[model samples]
Target: MVPLLVILLTLTGAWAGRPVLLPPPHAADLVLPPDQWFTQKLDHNNPGDDRTWQQRYQVNDTFYQPGGPVFLMIGGEGPATAIWVVAGQWIEYAQQYGALCFQLEHRFYGESRPTADMSVENLQYLSSEQALADLASFSAAMTEQYALPEGTKWVAFGGSYPGTLAAWYRLKYPDMVHAAVSTSAPLLAKTDFLEYKQVVKDSIYAKSGEQCYMNVQQAFADAEQLLEHPIGWRSLTSAFQLCAAFDGTSSLDGNNLMQILADRIESVVQYNEDNRAFSGHKDANITIGSVCELMNDESMGVPIERLAALNDLIMTVHEETCVEHRYQSLIDKMTDLDFASENNDATRTWIWQTCTEFGWYQTAEGAEQPFGQHIPLSYYIQQCIDAYGPEYVWIYGGYDQSFVDAAVAATNAKYGGRDLATSRVVLVNGSIDPWHAMGVIVSSDPALPAVYINGTAHCANMYPARAEDSPELVAARQQIGDLIGQWLQED
Candidate 1:
């Protein structure tokens, strides 16, 4: 059920059919953020795609400052809503910059859920194009129904998966949007499985400092090599997947391993903000978080367990306290480990399978990377590819993704400068982010620029380091933000 709220009136700039620009934080609406209400319901049913969707959006900005820009917030690959934990943050961004923020939830996420039978065919309708079209339609309807005030502009903003949508919106319907800000979003599709994997490895290694990383890598390698001979890698894969799941039970089997894998994935993607400042490093922000989290913590928490809905490969570092979400039926049959190197019959398979399977997975086009997730990029990229040409567009990756650099170069070279309007795709990377490439766009004409930030990880859509670094990083990020603010403030 949609949460009902009383809309705030008496906004500072709502008078005389024009906006009364409030001075930054002093704005009345901002100090007392309006209780933005939403109307969510299915808007269509595509029988061919076997899908139906509900559109949850805010329509009553009647009290909005007369001339403020209409800020539309778009979500990432998964299903999400404006009521998201981040809405207030976005509102702050808008209020700080003097714009009205309206968020749209992607399908199968949050409130914009799909009808029954959310199968592949049904999911197919959740493509980027469909999402954009939905946004366009929603805006048009809202504008007419609400009688949008004069001199209003529209801008889109998002990070990560949602960042991809923002970029796509700018490219697909340049006329509809004034400008967009995409943070830490790789324009390229999911092909960095390998690169992502490696970056996390290195980052974790670095975070632990030289000696710890060295020791751990060696241990992992030693463990990996040892398992290859005496027993099949399958046993190790199961062990890795199981240990990562932390369900620890007497019985461990293939099905249980898969379930554990699914649970791990659920928590990582559930979007835990605490992970960002947790200091203990539990954010689903990177593979290291996943691996680190799974390794550190064991029990399933309320958030990560939901990953089972997406897939069974979502392994993360278990470093937090969590609740149990599984039956643990097979946990009793599992054999225990002895640290002395006995052939871990059950856990070993999980370890071997994950190590082998994830490592073996290639890029969208089969290229390889050392550090990306075989799953996230591919799964998310499919959202765009399934709608646009499989290769009709371009994709870029960061060092954190598996073999992201190579995959990015390939995709960029293939699609870069291929066209003018849509050609000249760029893959931006953060030099410091192991999962990403050097914030450089290689796909567009002459290749896109790789914007760089020293001592920053994962392209930093929000780049917290900006506030904590040398004047150069701060200046650079400020300059970018300034450009965005300028564009936003215009027209």
Candidate 2:
């Protein structure tokens, strides 16, 4: 799954300047369902307050039989696309089991507006607690609306953050959902996610050769050395074709540039060999192998020079003129409170959740990682403070690292972190996906199976089957299907 925070950062010029790609068209034979809305509570915790908002949802009952199970496809930090109801591996499962399928857009994302604008006061209503409540309410409402049987079995399916929610939902409300399939879900809430980059480094070494890995490490080292000198800064600016000159003395600017460079490779590695149709890019074939081929090309000069050329190649693919390295530009874009703003709305919402509930900040503080230690945990904390305010940061206690640590701990405590003891919830992770480090890759309980695809990227099994799919991925899907079938039969 393409993380919503990364998408937002890319849009606001904080990360790599990659063009946002929409999901490719669904199967021609499948008919796309129309958007439907249900009234959801603004604050699920308050009983007296009757405030409500319109939550968007879609249903595809093309293969649903009268007494078959119901499949709920939970939306994540991004907008819920209609294509999900028509296509995806879950849709195939629905067809096989004659199950009714539904996709509900998360609050404050897509068209599910809970308030007029994204003011700090309004955003208080948006939380995972409230979202889970929304799901419960949605389930009861759907039952009444569709006249589903009292004991109808419901299976939850989600990927990425939604995947986390899917597992948590079953844990919190077992009666509502009988089974859950969580793909690439980070069960642990961490403040400094250094292991994320570590996994990326390992995946690079595993997919590409040692030379590619060494060159990437060397490139980051060289870039860090250049940032120390003013002349070197100018040279890098010219080579990378930056929109504005970077301040050599400012660590923030240096970190921004370094983070941007890291994001370029991270994105490629995170979605390595994922279906082009799922990624919605014509050149979705960009993989670790392709990136290694570029890095190993000696004609591009030194490692740093090759890195610059790679940046240029990414810009060319996205049709961007120059890389934006100014940190304040990113701040300005994220600080915009207008919900009507094109792309930053979803970013703002997700970032707020990260600050409040989950601190999944991917920092480069790990010693062994290829990326330099420029992007410290403080950079992300500062972003939260700048985007929201000191009040939001101080709400957890203080604006220091301890506050984030405490907040993440609270999140994990509320829901079982990595030691999630839930039944009939299959945890799925791709071995190459960086998020897997935080997920439950091994299960202690036989009922709670964990499927780790050997050579796959994020959400690889969530997408429809392909001829190029790895044998491991194919086997994982079959196992998941068999598990779901067994659960339904038991029900």
Candidate 3:
């Protein structure tokens, strides 16, 4: 990840490079009359803001008018609904604190989809640099359009990947967005696949009912054999992807590896009737029973070899269609060993990266790169690390050893200035959340402990943030929000 070319505007004037503002380029779009409801639009831009490309935005709570401090919502992976459902919270927050709330869907999902045929060449334009630009423009436009307090601070709120983005907003556009609230953000300095790996390990070895431990162990061993023998690179890659696709999906029941393939993969995979909004569990679906039962492959499910063989074909074609077209170059390099370090484990070689083309292979002739943006996201972390200090941004792990080390190095505080805003972080884990464990605390400074929330569940907001009718939770959440306001205090 290259260091983000942060274009912070201290000028306090009309922006240059007027961005396009209107309906999306192509897609059956919907426009709702400004009302207090879930008004879904394919692509809409604020008429203000002059610094954006044909960037897209999804506006919520548009009816909340010209007075309050505006809140910009950042959605996580996939076209999520929390931005709207949580609108209830912001409604009150706005009324109480005089803040108006709204959210934008991330690239690659929903109406915010890139019009450029989803190829890497065009997708590279979708990098965080562009997103950051789009955000800045969006913020400025909103500020100008809403005519809120002359200096009403803009706040960025996100969880998971978007959580890291919020933290980044403070680091990059500190003045534009004076507040950031990041929940379960993985803002390490390096490309660590360990974060997801730990989830797999815990799901199999530590948790009950889901035999992920015994199951993955065997699959991993078999995968190792295939890697060594090279009967076909296809099976090995398939097994690896099968293991890596558990982040937002996996459940207490079984490994319906099928659904992981559906929600995430490029294929047109179908889902059972159940699909609901989740903050943490983006992949929560009706396939948990089958996914958990996948551990019993030897007894009742598809053979590991055959599953790998079949999945290799399915996921490969899926990637070719969804991921391949955009990130052709990245994908080509994905199979190579150029990026793999001797220090990195062989176990994680085939896993897909949310950060970089960690795979060492180069793309084949004529294939398109499906991944958007060439900006190594690591650069953003490094900027934070350099400016904030190694401890400023953290890589918390619950025994995801690989990820822990990678994250610490990637987002180390050694990148920039020394005036640290946040020097400690907590990697909270549900005691049973297979994503993390007690032994993996990278830095137990105690100022911020890697909290193992006992009896609480993994992806806490998956079912709770909405059901949070408890006055206790609401008051506690309010305190957190206020703290966020104070954290991004203007420099």
- Please name the candidate that would achieve the greatest lDDT relative to the true structure: 2
Cα lDDT of model 1 by residue, 157-251, tens digit: 55544554555555666556555554445444333334443443445554444543343333333432423343533343443533333322322
How large is the C-alpha RMSD of every model relative to the true structure? Answer: 14.0, 5.1, 14.5
State candidate 1's TM-score.
Answer: 0.54
Worst 10 residues of 1 by lDDT: 9-18
Model 3: per-residue Cα lDDT over 1-491, one tens digit each? 11111111110000000000011111123233232222222233433533322333444454354443566665444443333423333444444444455565554433354443333223334444345555675666665665545655655554444545555666676667655544334444334222333333333333334353454345434533443343434443345453332232111101122212222311111111111233222233323334434545566444354334434454453353322212222223333332233322211121222222221111111112111112223322232223222222242212233443453444445322112244322233333332232122244454233334333323232222444334434444565545434433433
Residue 488 lDDT in candidate 2: 74
lDDT of 2 at 124: 90
Residue 488 local lDDT, model 1 = 48
Model 3 error, position 59 (Å): 3.3
Please estimate how well model 1 matches the true structure, expressed as its whole-model Cα lDDT. Answer: 0.37
Instruction: Say which candidate scores most in TM-score.
Output: 2
